[model samples]
Target: MLAPVLRKIIQNKTVMIERYLPSKGNLFVQKGDILEPFQKLGDCMHSPNTVYFPKEFEPVKFLREKVYFQKGSLIGKIGAKKVTADENGYMSFDEVSGEYFYEDMPVKFTLLSGLWGEVSDVIPESSVLIKTVVAEVDLVACTPNFSFGELVVFPNPTEILEKFYLESFVKSTEGKIVYVGHYADLDTIKKARDLKISAIVAGSADPVGFSFAKSANIGLGVVSGFGKLETPDFVYKLFNSVAYRHVFFHGDLGVLRIPMSGVEEETVSSKKKKTPLKVIKKVTKGQKVQVLQKPHFGKIGTIDRVSVSSIFVRFDNELGPVEIDLPNFFIIE
Candidate 1:
């Protein structure tokens, strides 16, 4: 019988990533240029403190292009009401567009390559596309968001230890993607959000906490099924080995991507000559499977025997082989 195969982890897959700025910015790399993870790609002046005024508003003679103004400084009027600058910035009037705008001091933002790759394409003053090889981990459930940062893997924590674990890294957690252990509770989710963490990955999460993450727009990815399930041993070990590596959390695609090294890319290129990995296969004895139902949800076991519509699986910790319906488990390839 043919069964669906779930790929928990895939290694050395080539992908293209586009890194862009919020506004028009400089591009430093050209096509075919090789880049390292720490390489600087470009920089931009980002201004989020801009305000617009009605076209009908009249401005003082002193309100000229590039004229600096401080908070509460009056520079114009809309009929009898006087308009003041809300923050310190330069003033400008666009005659062609008939628009008045106040912009605060722009913040300088530097862009990093973030991966080992070759520049595949570049859009001037906007974005750069890099072709790179990476390792991908499938997530069963995830919030619909996108985030990229250094991956932080914590030791599996008990309920009481969760807070302490978070506090230990409080200063370094901001803008990072962290693995919060076997299951994430509501308190853990709240603490992460407060710390300004970019996103969180867990083995499983409380449905309530998962809902909160979605509503709050925090990126959350679950590797295993929900409700108090342990992270599969293999997945946990893989994450532990790659702590502090640059990673991408694509919640919409339900995958975590970790860029691979140049040597790994070479190995992948060599393997391209071989047959590709399979995503579906015939059920057989001795195959590894992950249970999707209660009693053994998220547990991995080896198939001992295959029946007409069920398979008998043997768990290392269980006393005897357990019969599982075909639909309740999937082959882990």
Candidate 2:
């Protein structure tokens, strides 16, 4: 019998799916079997399929490698991190002995079912200790869905190479990306970031250029515009520029349950011409309008009722919700 459950659970692992239908309550067991429900059925054989062994889930890691920014060595020591839980059900960390925590401690909702048992009592920060544990867990819940799986596609070598430039080879040993992008000031970066320009190919970046990137949540690529630029010099400069990595770590960790509102399509009226539900309008606003890019990618919140140009946008991209300067942006089509 065909079963989607078996196929979805064991994405990579081989499995034999058996089915017996007729007013049964979802789960069924073999007549002569004595093993538990989640236990493997057999030697992966087919037939009456006395049991079912769902496929095993293999994880995919997604990371952008070959950073352009540079000079990212740690001057101080990273003390032992105290992993603990907070009231908001989040994994957090504080320095134990030293005074600083390692900047890149891998945050976000990653599946660890096969690795850890049912996560229960969480210390203040997730890196700390697990206080409680549920005896046994349903493997189904532990299995990551296609959505979460897409979050981290394993980094391919080619993917790594594309992130770096010609004159610059990137290294990420001490939890930081070092690079040398060519730019003048914060406004220059703002202009470049708006254009989605990866590198600023020019002169020495203004001293405050790094600060601008940090504030705007943008990464400065070490461009070749600066005369006689090399990897080491770039890395050192970008390193002292920003004290911490630009990774955003927020919210709960155990079973990251966000509203999985999938991809949505909408249209806006060129003028007052209404069609379906176009959540918000932007790129250009009238005297009264607000537009925003949001924590939810592709999702836009509109303030049409109160004013115009007041909208928020969210994309699945790492940039989170971008506060598009509505007056400065425009609709292409």
Candidate 3:
């Protein structure tokens, strides 16, 4: 009998997506419109923050209720204490304290589409729904976050991410999604945040560091068990193949998304066909698995027998089958 596949999470290639703006804005794309990566979708004008000046300035000279001044123009001085308009905007005087308050003019902002897709619906001045095809990879653990950027993979998947290697990419990794290697410690996690990286993917992360990343609002993903573990070859190959492409990290859902172009037919067809459900079954002989403990850690073996919580596995290097606990082995797909 065949051993059933466990945790067979479905990774959809063509996914329906909806992106909401921070606030209501002018929507540019309508239904049936196609969108490319980073295409402008909506925009709005936002007011600059208000700046409060000290009450020392002479309020009588600027008490016109609304006085517009050029950026960097001096408003007034109070005995060698010069108060300048940091930005071009109107100012109002406080009658009680005589402090000059400056409010800058509104600034225009544009929101990008961030993915390739077909516009499915338009929520006026708020959000847009689209259908897009992508490559997906399942992760073992991740914090909640959504991010899109070019994927940059590390050269080695077994090496621990050190401060030196991360410092090398400090300048170039800003606003980009970076993939550190197999293991990441607190030092590596802190450096990534300092570099202003949009997100990071790794094989395994320290539990404490993982919590810190979540608190700091930095995106992090792990594809293997906790502690120092090498990323599975299957997952590593998938990420490496899609290098430099625009990818999305659905950290809450534990999936990585890689957008693809020029395959509309396949993408649409795949969406129409429903995926088969994964069912649990009894473990049987000849089932392949990856060992998760030392002495046999990182080794692939075949099941020789199933007895209670202990499973007997036959590794190629061992003279006889060895017994392993349930939590120490995962069936290879």
The candidate scoring highest on lDDT is: 1
* Backbone collisions counted per model: 0, 59, 0
Residues forming the 10-long window of minimal summed lDDT in candidate 1:
266-275
Ranking by TM-score: 1, 3, 2
Give lDDT tens digits, candidate 3, residues 1-333.
334353422446469878767656798989999999789899877654787676566643747587888988888777788778778888887678666777788688677777788999999999899898765667778889998778888765334435556777778888788888777777788888999888988878889999999999999988765777666665676678767777889987888877766563354344223377545456778876777777777666789998877789998679999988877777764
- Candidate 2 stretches greater than 4 Å from native: 1-108, 111-125, 128-188, 191-204, 214-333
lDDT of 3: 0.75
The lDDT of model 1 is 0.86
Which parts of model 3 have CA positions greater than 4 angstroms off? Answer: 1-9, 45-108, 157-162, 262-274, 279-288, 298-327
Per-candidate Cα lDDT values, in order, are 0.86, 0.25, 0.75
Q: Would you list the clashing residue pairs of candidate 1? A: none
TM-scores of all predicted structures = 0.77, 0.17, 0.68
Question: What is the lDDT, from 0 to 100, of the residue 131 in candidate 2?
Answer: 18
The true-versus-predicted C-alpha distance at residue 66 of model 1, in Å, is: 9.2
lDDT at 2 for candidate 3? 30
